[model samples]
Target: MTNSPKPRARGADKRRRLMAAAAQVLHRQGVERTTIADIAQAADVPVGNVYYYFKTKDELVQAALAEHAGGLAEFTGELDKLPDPLDRLKAMVGAWVGQRETAARYGCPTGSLAVELDKRDDGGLDLEVGKVIRLLLDWVERQFRELGLPDPDDLAITFVGAYQGMSLLANALRDPEIMTREGNRLTRWLDDLPSAREDGG
Candidate 1:
């Protein structure tokens, strides 16, 4: 008889499920509106079991922030595979465009969360949100640096800020096509940059 697949590690699997579910629920419902029981139900794990992994809702939200940071790392890593720096930047724009529908439905995942968390006097979680934004900014800066742009940092900020502003507009207007149009404009901006090293060596 064919051998059956091995059973997954229950403890680790539950924690992973809890973290993923926390991210999803927190994205759908803001942190102020979400609770441990909500995440437990979304994760399909017992409410008591959630405490075994995270002692409180704040801890669970922290886990979700870490999960988002991890996702950002993976995202930049994929962009690293492309040979052209401009292409990588353009691809990033394309990714935002692809998520237009989701953005319109619930706003940019990290952006909305950060805005909500920023209103609080609490310290740690706000820093975690900064880390996520930093990851994207730093990655974009590196691409501009490689392209020999004189103001890589400023360019990176502009690039990412434009996307963030567009995301806000898309959500505010409930229009997904705004992202598509802005993405195309951003791609054109990238393509119009000087092909030669701007620093003149």
Candidate 2:
């Protein structure tokens, strides 16, 4: 008897589906309420299959956090396309505000994960969140360096802290307009920096 053709590996596809499902669950139900069962159901996979990929709920949470970080990294790439560092900074801020607005409409997967991950004193989850934050901070610092700033690290930290604080406030108040305004103000401040001014001139 002839052997039938073997199915494709499909492992990558299955992993992507699981991550997408986890993001949906986190966005809709909040990270604390999201369960393995919910992710399995959302992905249309058996519980055993989910367990095969993730040994524990925390592992799955970390995977979801990685996915969120991946998305932010992609946003950084888009900002890098701009020639001017000040423009790049503004684009980055605008992209973040736009993402927050979109997430508010459906719910924020990253914000939900951040809330839970931040509370834990020790875990891989916190590390995953740190990775995401660090990536964004690094991107911001790169822009500052390109602008010839004297203190890229400090300025990047300040920029990221202000952005995150404004985002949390906007999300809490359910006010995208506030986020937009504050983000623009911050961007303008960066643009007016001496280094940026000389670069632009």
For model 2, residues 53-160, the per-residue Cα lDDT tens digits are 888878777777777777878877777777887888888777777766754444345655677778877766766777777888888898888777888999999998
Model number with the top lDDT: 1
lDDT of 1 by residue, 1-201 (tens): 997545457788898889999998998898999999999999899999899889989999888988888888998899899999998999989999999998887888889889998899977788888888899899999999899877999999999999999999999999999999999999999988886565475
User: Candidate 1 at 96: error in angstroms?
Assistant: 0.8
Task: Candidate 1: list runs displaced more than 4 Å.
Answer: 1-8, 198-201
lDDT for each of the candidates?
0.90, 0.76
Angstrom error at residue 185, model 2: 1.1
Query: For candidate 1, what is the TM-score?
Result: 0.92
